[model samples]
Target chain A: MKSYFVLIFVAVFMPVAMLAYSIVPKRLRGYVLLVFSYAFLMIMSGRPVVYLVAATLITYVTGLTMGHFQARRDAQLAEVKKGKKAIKEACKRTNRWVMVAGILLNLGMLFALNYLGFFAQVGSGLLSLFGIDKTFEPPLWIAPMGISFYTLMAVSYLVDVYRETVKPDRNLGRLALYLSFFPHIMEGPIARYSEIAQGTWEGNPINRQNLYTGFMRIAVGFAKKLIVADRLNLFVDPVFDDFSLVNGGIIALAAVLYTIQLYCDFSGCMDVAIGLGCIFNVSYPENFRQPFFSLTTSEFWQRWHITLGSWFKDYVYYPVSLSKRVKRLTTMARKRFGNKYGPLLVSSIALFCVWFLNGLWHGAGSQYLFFGMYYFVLIWLGGLIDPLARSLATKYGIDRDSKPYRLMRRVRTLLFVFVGELFFRANDLPSGLAMFKRIFTHFSLETILNGKIFNIGMDPADFIIAGIFIALVFARDYAYEHDHNLLAMISGKNAVIRWAAWIAIVMAVVIFGAYGHGYIPVDPMYAQF
Target chain B: MRDQIIEILEDINPDADYETCTTLIDDRYLDSLSMVSLVAELEDTFDITIPAVEVTANNFNSVDAITKLVERLVEEDED
Candidate 1:
């Protein structure tokens, strides 16, 4: 079947669904969401809906099982006249086993579906090196769309239930709706159970203001995707497809363009998701927060794909760092290396694990792995030099928070992020390295200024249009960075001006958007993950 | 016991008035790292095992809540 994801479909589906959603009774609105979501999934994913249902079932049952054991243990403890420790220990052991089984089952399915092929290829190649020739073919696996997202969400669900931070929802449908919620299924803010579950079930009646805001938000998202990201893809595809032929300037320009493309594409998708949720009065957590304004690599991560980083931090980083083994290692390292560097030893090891998983979670590619390591090294180096930098600033009486210093730090962080995206966008690890080599070795100012950029599928006019849109995006982001809302500003204007502005945005997208003719639709970037 | 819990909170983050800050976790006065350290410290100082479930904000939102949680766990251990 031909893919049903066209611009026209999105334009129609959103309004129609919103209308239907508003017509439903308030209490039944949650089920309307479920029906809409599953319908969307069936249309988009088809057979792979099995994976979503299975993940929901396994996690749902696991949660109930864990909760049941916890209750039994509490009751048993109350009944016992003595030896509560023994009872508690036994319960802990059983719950730990159940948690392990739950995590392993879901993760195993994900690994088998996604990474099994990559591992098989590597394994067979290794075998050939030892004078044994055997061709091993991995089984064909059709992984469900959004497996990365829902799997991570499921793990968080189990962890939250296990930690008793939130009780397991006894209603399987609510849990199902949470996992399969259509707007966020493809690309997620990776919401926590405690954060969004109650609101999902509360099903607040649709409001007129929310409709106006949601439609405006969706229009802005379409403008970003259609006007900026897709148009830039024309140039980015050609340059990245054959990096060896391009000189330093073109590659550098392409790197910068790719970064813009990635941000607009991913964040634009988030806008649609969040805007769709707004219609139902379900405000999902934000995924992006003006990431380009970050002053450090750490701050960059905090602002970029915020949910994923927070998920990794809360679920992976904290657990690993606080575990008894890491605690013991911290003590030993402190004794051996002194207090200053000792704690870093534990942090570095845990950070390594976090990055390793972070890289793998992106996809089954070695380049993705390197992308993770690149940040890990940068963050670690930043940590190592932090005290020295602070001391020097203090000694020199320099205000590090001053405008110039902050600007300088932001520029440095921007370059770091651009370089990381260069690796991430490359075809493979070696090609990324070669591109880096060309960037430094084959530098030429004439190539960029003399109009070589216009030769790559896009004319000068295309660049100008894309450039204008990019500037608009930057201005809006800058305002947003200062916590100013442009939409709200528009709303405060007179009726004629406000209506004119909204009409102008919609018209500009239709007239200048990259879609209508000869435009190849570029899939949303993070949707692949 | 409340004083002891406040001392631990102050040791971790001295800026916030832990005794009266009922929305410590909600307002992000205490982040994940500080919370982890706080949990470890509470367990060590009170000689009570704080299960992962008790890490919720309901039990650690203020010194009073934390004191109550610790006392309950301690009493359970004695039983």
Candidate 2:
């Protein structure tokens, strides 16, 4: 009940839900999904499920209202040739207001539930700075499960409707199911209305091909979670929790391990989510695209948590950067600085907003903000330096696209990512800074030289197991990066090979998974956010 | 108009074969920063408002796509 990986959910709840969904008539299948979605939400967050309902209702009403105005506008346009411009302008203005109101309402709820307390604490701290003794008692709010995921989806849907990219769903139940489909409710690919809503509503029966592919994908997710991520957690958690006890070398190693742990854990969960969606004949968008293979920080964001990045790009970045005021600034700056640096200067304003909100969206924490700013600075600097770098390479007769150069860039990007994740995983901004400082100031190889590395939570055997699995995962990602779809390749193979692959995955998880005796199963990492 | 659009693309990022490359965005030839510069240049050059909604792959993925988008927006501006 707590997470998708739990035995109760995996063994009991999913089987029952799938059975019920399969047995239900085609006409009632969507309702069945709606019912289970709500039931899952209720079990997870109880009364807070009301917030999801409120969001769905607000989105539904907003869409219909805009639709109504659009209809009227079209009718009037059809009836008249003169004054059509004025009529269209009037309707556009009204719909804009309606869309803005809907967006604000949805975002307002999210802010109250997730961010109010953090902001209040900051407010109180500022007050005390001026010799004020009074403190504002922030409300304790239990956010509904997947509030972050769903709210973004809700806003995307609303905006898409306003943009006429997606027609508003008049069917409340369909919209409800789109928002609350149990698989994506927890950690989402932040699916758009246009992406999977129709397929979801169609409720196509679970054909054998889909079922096999879905189960195979789920098995891969389980293998990733059980074997690699959980095992690494044993070493990663304690180091982060008690970072001060370890030297810089160990701290550095821990950071690298932590980044791997996080990728596996988060992407593994996404695999399960998408697999479940596949079982139900809905294809959730891919969230991770071999993020480790990216060569630049900007490219890394494009690859990692892809939906979230694209969400910000479509909703926040493009809008802010292309707004009238920013566009005017861009024009002015471009005139002054020329084509390369001018628009970039203005675009930085929009980039700053994206990173600032991106940080806050993770959680109301200073470290998260710092993490966002870290990437922002790196990306902006990269943009600023790219032209110079390219010119220098040309002047020096260096091949920027050569494998060595690409490898160097990938390593550099990974180093940057490791540091960012250090801040992201640290207790706070100060702790992150302290740990980072130690990496350079208190550097040492004594931990490895003295055989102390193995003593810190993970033995040599643990390392071997984790290393083997990590390599396997890396190979799979490498194949994917090269356009080799492992699943498809397997699916197209003979029964013996397919069955062997499945059995190997299952046997690996059952045998080498970091559970049972002393291992603590890590909760789905991205679920908290 | 098409030639002017190609000039803008060349100025933005001359690495690609704009005449034949249709995967400018898809292949990362036109990164986000490049997209921003391209949009601003196109707007200033054409004297048309390119709203954020029009900044999709279908509109900016190639020389032909960018030419069509600018022409369409220019037409809309006239209307």
Top DockQ hit: 2
What 10-residue stretch in candidate 2 chain A is worst by lDDT?
A41-50
Let me know the DockQ for model 1. Answer: 0.20
Q: Who wins the lDDT comparison?
A: 2
What tens digits encode model 1's per-residue C-alpha lDDT throughout A495-524?
Answer: 688778878988988898887676778877
lDDT of each: 0.81, 0.90
> Candidate 2's residue-wise lDDT over A1-529, tens digit each?
6777677888888889899988989988889888988888788665648899999999999999999998898999999988888998999899999999999999999999889988988999998999997777768987778989999999999889888898889999999988999989988989999998888889799898888888888889988898999999988888888888889998999999999999988999899999999999998989999999998999999999999999999999999999999998998998899899999998999999999999999999999999889988998999999999988999999998899999999999999999999999998999999999999888998988998888778888999999999999999999999999999999999888988988899888889988889888677888788
Misplaced by over 4 Å in model 2 are A46-48
Q: Which ten residues in a row have the lowest lDDT in candidate 1 chain B?
A: B27-36
Off by over 4 Å in 1: A1-5, A46-48, A491-499, B1-79
DockQ of each: 0.20, 0.88
